[model samples]
Target: MLGLDKKDFTLLLIVSALVLLAPLLLNPFPEGSAMAQFNAGYPDLMQRFVIFGIFAIGFNILFGLTGYLSFGHAAFLGAGSYAGMWMLKLLSMNVIPAIIFSTLIAGAISFLIGWISLRRSGIYFSILTLAFAQMAFVLAASVLTPITGGETGLQPALSDPRILPEFLGGGSVTADGNIPKPSLFGIEMTASSEVAVGNWLWTLNWGYYLSGFMMLVAFYIAIRIFRSPFGLMLKAVKSNQQRMSYTGLNTRPYMLACFVISGMYAGLAGGLMAAMDPQVGAERMQWTASGEVVLMTILGGVGTLIGPVLGAGLIKYFENIFSKINKATLEVWFGVFPDWMTDLMVTIVYPFIGKGWHLTLGLMFMAVVIFLPGGLVEGGQKIAKLFSRKKEPETPGGEAKPAE
Candidate 1:
């Protein structure tokens, strides 16, 4: 089915179903209701979920399979954003062209960076990549101000000469005094169709679906890579480079290839973000952003094909939840508790939310590292197996019988 073995095909089906149903699942409250604050079914967050999923999935290709931990991958992401923004600024508002440009630019830059960095292994390689990324970050902020829009970042301009879409005003401005929006052949990405049934209102946006579709494609490609002979070589590289050297197989090219591919993935994600929001900030290239993707991959379970996606969604969702929580929101949820209890709960939880959300994320990472280095997926599987074992029938000799 779908050119995949049974297990792979089933996994694909499950992921597809989840992606398609996300809007409904994420939005469980009515639009006008007070609880709507908790609903993340909106287009912006939905787009982020899938976009970051693509980023995580790509990073997984390199770090998970080959164990080449690049601390500078976010530089590629920022580079892609700039490329996408340029395409919009110079070429057209059509997302297709922007996405293509993003992929190509990121891949070229990554190829160069990988060529230089792959010369060293272990911590040395990590440092080289980090240094390159820091240089790019500094350039983007200061010396390259004219090109990168400086600290203010790149935003669609009123003066851009959109050569292709001559009749239409460039992005950030539409012809009829309407705010400009990214589109595909004039179909606006921000456009949405809202269906209200009872108290629930589901918003299906062009941008979210497009991002989700791209994520699906990326995920499929990752599945193929994981099953390929090249993927086996990456695993071998991770397991023992010395053994591979003994086999007379050069691993540098393979490592470079993995780095380039993963960099392209980051670029794709950054381009999508620019297309959706019509802005590209140098902040996207920060080392912290690179660290976040690594955290997402490890939190969800590194080396497992679906782990990165799960981790991205989980982290992003929690980030949103944490950012939105405030004293008022906490009060609403804890209203039933006594005053002292509510106050105590609020005190305990307040530090984890809002500006202190990073503390929460760090604690979660530490817990995952200490308790289950295999990550959440392994922990979940263990719990499931434990439950299954407990549910099994015991035989006459006090041995457990196989579950029927």
Candidate 2:
């Protein structure tokens, strides 16, 4: 069976439980507690962590398994977001159809791009994909203004027309002259708040939970793909393309399949983002976003099942949380030191730690590349080995051996 061993399976379950319960644990401190500032229980950020986790996992399947480094993945993700938003505008707010349609659209787009890009391998393929993505970004920004909403971006408005229940007061009456945001069944998905620890705080509302649930589903699907026979075939293509060709196997179709599948995953993540926020912008498909996914996969640990999730969490943490910390906050922390020391420390570390969180991330990436080329997972394994070594038995020859 293509599955984890007992220990690994148990570990996965424990991790899943921990993730699911994170909000409660993180929010346990009272509102006025000093540690409350560090709490990360908000639904929006948690949802993003998982949503991007799915994105990174999908990217890893292509880059990690096939050795194909795509620099245009955000094209598919942005495409999916647009497709899903259109569905919300035209049809019911149910996420099922939105996700399905978005995935299909993303797969179709990826297929076309892959067909052309796969004609060349190595840097040529990367350049082809990059060019296509840049074209997409520009088109979304300009030519498709009517559909894409141009620079201001597309957002949910009550002006949108709904087809069903028009005569029964359930459909497009234009009463308020504003299009209502999409909803699941009858539950509205706008931003909302809740009281936690006697403090009023913003929660994910319905849309965030819906997005989180979809992320979990995406994660499960990715896990299945990682264990599937098709995945094995893709890995084979990655490992020895020449050998596979000599064995009469056509590798192009397999590579294309992998590319499409990965694109669909990116699309799913994009769809969820749109579903939660009901907005689509050209910037989402930019090459920088595509490079972000690459960073996520490499930093987390390519080829390992859970590494993408770790990488996604790490990057998202930096993007959302760390970037929000500014020089003023540093000044507050450094106020405890002598005047000269405070000024010196703030001047020295401010550039990299505050708004320049990306600089720190870059340094981290370089360190990982230099010392732990396999990424964080390899570092974790090395730590585990170090701890386990002490328990190992010494053989008669003075070499370490199994304890038993």
Candidate 3:
């Protein structure tokens, strides 16, 4: 109805429903249960899900549409965070200005980087982006100490000249001794209230809802882009760039535009991060951080619109659950079994949890790559197809039952 095709609009509805119901769906285990650890309905983790979903969505725009795989998207994210943090420190504690500043600054940086890197294609392009990211990380950590706060990272302090906020009859000072938290107008993002129904507790945090609202907006933008003629050109670039070039189309601008847009998305995600936590660290620009978003996109379904969001949530949920499983939790899980069986089972599964969550992630990624390279969305499609085949087709007179 809103210029979206039936399937695309349907997909949007499904995503909207899932996101809206996530607080209840994710915390189904209740307050006191053996499976409570698996519940990921908390505010912070939910924020991460939406933020990373935005990151993966942006990444998919470039990688899925234009076939340009970046190994350094985290640089834009870090740049955005730093920019947002500086805005918070210098101007005001309101998150709106900070996020806006982050998106604009990150877009400019990505434009410059894309202009330089688009000269090369394939692995050379990936390597150039990686080199730029590593340089950013190094400079933030060492050479740019005065600006970036070096190893300590950039943080809001009490001594900054917040001219705008002070003139507005408000400041970062709080009634408590601690530094002020990030806010929207006068409403603090970190402020939250809880809803309780019986043993179930749901946290409704302002930051989470704000992030979720941004996610919906981002998703809508992605849908629009995916349906546009520009998206067709990007797909053409991916399918056959030589033909596009021969047709007198300057593919460089299209590729560069995709890169900058994706980078700006990353920056927006990073700004949300700063808005929630008010902290910016150099580790955010690390190569590993960049790789995680790549994994999110591939593991979700690289080309699909909703796949990246699902993938980001899946990865984040697994990371949250697996990292919390310690020896003690394993013992509690195996308490029903005999001593020897329990010990053996715990011994086998122990390495894949806690600090070993990486092992679990690696195994999961391998399985998805090997069996379902199309990712979770493809797997879901296959399952649906199988179920549909099992349903009996109706005869002219009556519904036909499956043969015994």
| Top-TM-score candidate index | 3
lDDT for every model? 0.88, 0.78, 0.87
- TM-scores for candidates 1 onward, in order: 0.93, 0.88, 0.93
Top candidate when judged by lDDT against the true structure: 1
Estimate the overall C-alpha local distance difference test score of candidate 1: 0.88
Give the range of the ten consecutive residues with the poorest summed lDDT in model 3.
Answer: 395-404
Tens digit per residue, CA lDDT, model 3, 67-172? 8889989999999999999888888888888889998888999999999988999999999999999998999999988888888888888886555744331365
Model 1, TM vs. native: 0.93
Ranking by TM-score: 3, 1, 2
Clashing pairs in 1: none
Candidate 2 per-residue C-alpha lDDT over 1-404 given as tens digits, one digit per residue, 9 for 90 to 100: 22755655665676577566656654655676544665666777777887798799889988888888899999999999999887777765655567788889999999999999988888888889999999999999999999889888987666565544543223443456655555666565665557554563435456656665666666666666767888888788778888999999888998998899999999988888887677899999999999999889988888877888889988887887777777777777889999899899889888887678899888888877777777888877766676677665442332222110
C-alpha lDDT (0 to 100) for residue 77 of candidate 3: 95
Residue pairs in clash, model 3: none
Best-to-worst order by lDDT is: 1, 3, 2
Return the lDDT, model 3, position 157: 86
Model 3, C-alpha of 394: deviation from truth (Å): 19
Q: How well does candidate 3 match the true structure in TM-score terms? A: 0.93
Candidate 3 wrong stretches, greater than 4 Å: 166-172, 175-178, 392-404
What is the alpha-carbon lDDT of model 3 when measured against the actual structure? 0.87
